[model samples]
Target chain A: MKRRDFITATALAAAFGLAGKPVYNVLASKDALASKTGKRLAMVIDLKKFEGNSEMMNKCVDACHSMHNVPDIEGAKEEVKWIWPEPFEHAFLEQNNQFIPENIQNNPILIMCNHCDNPPCVGVCPPKATWKRAEDGVVMMDWHRCIGCRYCMAACPYGSRSFNWRDPRPKIKNITANFPTRSKGVVEKCTFCDERIVKGLEPACVVASKMYEPEAMVFGDLNDDKSNIRKILSENYSIRRKPELSTQPEVYYLI
Target chain B: MLDKIFTGGKKYWAWMIFLSSIIGAGTLAYLHQYEVGLGVTGMGRDVTWAFYISQLTFFVGVAASAVMVVLPYYLHDYKKFGKITILGEFLAIGAVIMCMTFVFVDMGQPLRVVNMFLHPQLTSPMFWDSVSLMGYLVLNIVISRVVLNAERNGVKPPKWIKPVIYTSIPWAVSIHTVTAFLYCGLAARPFWMSAIMAPRFLATAFAAGPALLIIICFVLRKVSKFDVGKDAIQKLAVIAAYAMFANIFFLALEFFTAYYSGMHHHTQHFQLLYVGLEGNSSLVPWMWTSTVLAAISLYILINPNTRKNEKILGFGAIAVFLSIWMDKGMGLIIAGLVPNPLGYVVDYTPTLIELTISAGIFALGALIISALYKSVLTIRRQV
Candidate 1:
């Protein structure tokens, strides 16, 4: 073709391409829009509902572990846990009291990854294997990329992360086909059920807790003021693990 | 030059054989660790870093301590240190190699370590540490090779090597400081989150590094009739003495801050190391042993008459070397992880496989130093 005719044709094509970009974006799905302007997901655990209730706590723990294929190793040193329970005193070290009632003091408090707004683990990772997702504020681990240096484990103040010291495949009692089981020599942790949330479903632990006691575990977007987590957090006196460190944990405990 | 390693005497061959055996054993243990995973070691979910990382920390100091000699000779034109500056540089090369090896062994996925360079995170102190250590290693190797070759040929070194030698001085300091930042920047572990960590590391490094050099000098003189001169030994002793003093003083400052402030988080680690926390006193004996050795070393090093005696000076050097090794290598890293994040005390003791692997790395360092020193002696004899 002649040079002038080619130039005119290119201009027409460029104009159409520019015009088509906005049209394509405008027709994008709702999920894509939600991801672009993401919500700050948070969780609220009602201490009154879970306190001294080991069965309910275990149910939540089992639901998370079974769904995620967390290894049920025998020893404490090599054990892998997604969600577990700690005594009230241990959970709230800053608020420990000598005069508190024994039952309340020894009560089991459900604990998992705080999914902090500013995660030190994400910062210390040499390979950027662990990072805080900008969309939902959930700290994530890329098992394939982790070199298993354990710097993230050391940096996590809440002990939320677990290392697969051995091949975890053999230890997983009932493997879930939906979620992937991590290999040995990688750090794994609670993902805030990113997979479930993306499917418009609540976290496994939250759904499990709701079966026994409604609203015992609440999960929602903290940015949405109308969400149950925001409403509960504002109405109740809540505390977080090691707030003085200023990790700004998203998980709150309503006492 | 590489052929000199194979041209050693009977005693040299025997020593090499011994080191090779240990290396062989260590290699076997490491293979097992690789097969079975890190679970074969004592490291747990709570105490993720222990013997391997601690040794890495200790050896980084040794590598950096080459600056103690390099700065005095090249900067101040100190004639006494001229004879031994090559020795110090070669020692740094060996220590840096060991540092890299320890890091490699501690990794859960040793093969994937290339990802560190592939997807480098500038924010991580570990990334900076790897960069500084590799740079320092290359600097020492180039300086030592060029300068020593010049000496063997009866000529001055090339002009470009002077700036490279000078760059090594600050570069040495950066390696240790960056290693310290690896631990100190972690807000989670309050035990390592101290401002004085870098200074304390430098102080102990200057002491331990020269102390080991003094012992090596004595051994070289007796075995190979290689006299590095009395003045060099005395000067090194004095440097070691002052560095030990600074180390103790810095440690005292740590004690005061931990105890006087009366904060549980700050004091708990000290309590665990010194006095045994909650009836778990696994580390108390080792800490006290280090303390006693440090005290004895200081007492002998400070007295002029005792420091003047060659026989006693060797003992003092050994004392200081062992003391700092125990403190930095065995105590510091483990104590920081005890009484883990959630107020649970889970003590860690290195498994046999772990110890074997560490022993192999130490033997490798010794083997490198032995081979390099042998070459130096052979070249000097020809001159």
Candidate 2:
């Protein structure tokens, strides 16, 4: 019944150009569900397949960038970066403590914003332009409210937040044609493909998970014992990067 | 102020024209940036912030330095600072304006500065930074106005302004503390996350601020016929010498930890400055030159005989100020951002547009100081 009401409200709001009111409508309903079920969203990535699947990483990047309307400029100082993969050695440099296997040496690790449990960027933002949603734990940026100070970019440990140095809307191609182009002078980061997750679909990258090894991808409710992620966590020797930093990053890796 | 301005004759107009031209050029450069966006600046993704922020940091230190003079003069009734405290206050006012302007240009959307308050985040250091900066600005303006009013009327200020003045003493310290936290609080940037950051900032602020005061006092004596007194100059130099000692000491401690512990991520930035990480060493020469100049300047400042000698004192003041400016403003921010957290190398060089706008902001500060000095001289009659 609640789902039926959401569909009706969403259809009406879109028809009447009450676009801004829909987020509140969805959030209010989510809060109601949370009070009863107490569920939280999370992901667990298998390192085995993700270590070498460049094709999978690229596919996911394309899908994420297209959906978010991120721009590609090689020379702009304040480039807008939504998602990108980094070499494994660089991504987990601190955690590479002499025990890792040689087969995975220098392989790429698909990374976006970690969506930390204790997000430093959220804590340091003076205007609360950046926030972690209590419902799904996706760290989000409100570009309209961001003052272009780039403080969040500085505070982010992963350098996930990208600043818009130039108008990014025009640069996006037809592949990313439908994405919302950000204006010049605001900070942006990965939202774990919230637009898709909201539609009862997996993240864009998760949907493209088949391009990589089956061991390379996992996403589910961390709070549910019946969830696949919980089963994997209880069985495998899973690890998160820079555990010493205590950021409690939601993304986990099984090496 | 208008009457005195007209009284300065041909020499004053000539000086005003010279200062105005520099400021005019700077303003033109600033407008160009506004039209084209921040793309005109040399900053890039890796070194996202460049000269403007460095200059802003240096000017903030300069603005905070006025507290040293103010505390001694007002709270302790140190008559030695009587002839000079007003100059410090006015210099601070100018520095604050420049600091604010530099920050403005560095912003991607200067118009959005209002967004800071409409949706402020208490958790972000930047939120605190904005609050502290605004608080200090209001405090400096109010104190300067009240103190000048008392000075003009030939009477002490009303009792109400005293508590505010005293409050600013601690508030002055807080400005630099918050600025340092802007860097040190970042968990990923290891080079910046040191606990010594706030203390180091205070030390450098004291060191560089007094050195600048020494030079300004000399310039005033030559150009405006202001008597800052040899005794006060010597005393301030001693203060600068101690501050420099503390600054260097803190730096040395940082070095010991980075090198001794030998954490690869931690040592990479330190190596970038002194020896160049990954064979890129452009900053190496600048860093070494700054260190050498600072050490020599400290030696000169520490010696009573050398400090009292106007020529040596002048050199020492300029050297110390420049060294601290390079170390804190340029090296600190850039080095912290290096070896991008992703373990990639990112280098930055300021472009012509960035340099011009920066120069213009500095010139703007000097222009205000020159005009204010002329007005105050006319009113005070050379103290």
Candidate 3:
């Protein structure tokens, strides 16, 4: 009878320790894990929709810059942009060899940082000031550590990194009040809205996907079987810009 | 009148005046850069490096080219270069000073130049470059002083100084080699990412640097009635010619490899430079100009007739020097980043702030060179 009582006590302890926790605690842990689970984030951009919808690209740009604190300069050509629209021919000069379109009015893409798997910028940084995160493979910059040598600027084939020749923070609207501002003498690039991602919000550009209806932007973990991005990759044919560079760019487009 | 001035008092003031003007201009430019910032320069995001770096690169080669003179004069005991060995060494000192200042002015924050030391990154070629440059400066000063003092006394230099001077020969080569390694080691930039980069840098350094020295010697001969001698110059020009030959060969090899392989990524940069890839032919004119100048200079140097004339030879050397400077220092490295990874053609232009700062730094270098040369000339006159 004593042995049976000891066995029952041990079983209860094991059950509580291994499988049973407070409901709130369990929910919080699950929420924390929801971000990391093999959701290889990928994009499937439909080029066909971009054929006539210049406004769609502009809307996406507005949403991204507003959240990311991208300043709008008077001369748009001189502006430092995280994402901006480019004509199809200029955007795909290497690939569009002979397929000269009669009417090239349609904007091809609003390309920004590719966030390549084999990022040349990260490889070239002398001070480890820039790095590619293993968690999500997003390349990030540490402004304080940068010496403004511009070697990484030479190293990056993507032309993704922008040096703050002047202080960019002042030109930014009140939006930068909450977000951190970059100082002069360092490189800056797109971070996929890391702050929003941490808070369970999608990238601002991805959230603004509704701007295009026929084939809106879709972002999901590439690793997860149920993620929308993985599903699209399997279902559709897409092309990555400058694949010959072997940078393995994460951004893709679908026609 | 020329002989009197060369042998007497007026020469001292003239040297000082010439040097001070060059240095003064540089200081003024630097001040403007400090007030406004790099925004004044044309340097943009795409072409992050510009004229400042190009000058720095050319000067580094000039600094290292002293090795050619030093090696033969010191190691081989080539008495023919004995009189001018000290001159080459002093010139190197000026070149290095200019090179260092150019890099400093090019920085966004000149105040934070020391930060490179405070937070050192061993992986960076720049860190190694900094260390090597400092080492070279210290060594050059010590060796130059010891030799100059001995020359003044009409006796052999201190036995200890011989080893140090000998050591500087290789150290001279290292200064520029490390500078070249700075670019070549980087794997991402296609123009710089080649095993041949270091060799090419050395070749260009030997050619352009020596050629520059020859021109300077000729200038001194004309202005101050100092003769470095035709024989010495002819030997130096031959060295420059051989180096130029190698530089051209390596460039051709790079062209062949990039084009013959037909790799799109590698070929794109070459196409951009020569063929006006996608209607952005801004660099084409510059590239062609460099090529034509280089060819003409090469022909002049290789031929016996034209090479014999000081006027023709001086012009040839200057042209070759400028062409190589354009090819290696500016166009090759800066224009490498076109049609960026996202396939966007971004243009980079240096602003006025950058230009002023660069000019100021260059002046600073000229000032140093002038001061050094003045001291050497003054001391030699006394002896």
Candidate 3 residue-wise lDDT, A1-255, digit = tens? 699999999999998877656655757652111234434455677776666777887888888887777766554223577777776665665667565664443555777777777676776565677777777767777777777777777776656667776667677876656777766666777887778777877777777766467347776566678777777888988887667767677778775
* Candidate 1 lDDT, A15-124, residue by residue in tens: 99999998898697332112325788889999889866889999999999999999899978998998999887777876888898876787789899999877889888
Worst 10 residues of 1 chain B by lDDT: B1-10
- Residue B29, model 2: Cα distance from true site in angstroms: 2.6
Taking every candidate in turn, the Cα RMSD to the unseen true structure, in Å, is 8.8, 10.4, 12.4
Q: Candidate 1 residues B1-383, lDDT tens each?
A: 54677787899999999999999999999999999999999999988999999999999999999898899999999898998898899899999999999999999998999989999989899999999999999999999999988988899999999999989999998999999999998889999999999999999999999999999999998779688899999999999999999999999999999889998998999999999999889989889999999999998899999999999999999999889988999889988888998888888889999999999999999999999988888888721
* Off by more than 4 A, model 2: A1-38, A75-79, A97-100, A175-178, A211-215, B1-7
> Which is the better candidate, 1 or 2, if ranked by DockQ?
1
Clashes of 2: 8
The TM-score values for the models, in the order shown, are: 0.93, 0.91, 0.81
- Write one digit per residue (lDDT tens) for candidate 3, span B109-165: 566667667766666677788788888888888888888778767898889987898
lDDT values for all models: 0.91, 0.81, 0.74
Q: DockQ winner among the candidates?
A: 1
Best by lDDT: 1
The count of backbone overlaps in candidate 1 is 0
From the highest DockQ down, the ranking of the candidates is 1, 2, 3
Residue pairs in clash, model 2: A123-B123, A124-B124, A125-B124, A126-B120, A126-B121, A127-B119, A127-B120, A127-B121
1 or 3, greater by TM-score: 1
Binned by DockQ into CAPRI classes (incorrect, acceptable, medium, high), candidate 3 is acceptable
The alpha-carbon deviation from the true structure for residue A10 of candidate 2, after best TM-score superposition, in angstroms, is 56
- The candidate that achieves the highest TM-score relative to the unseen native structure: 1
Q: Any residue pairs clashing in model 1, and if so which?
A: none
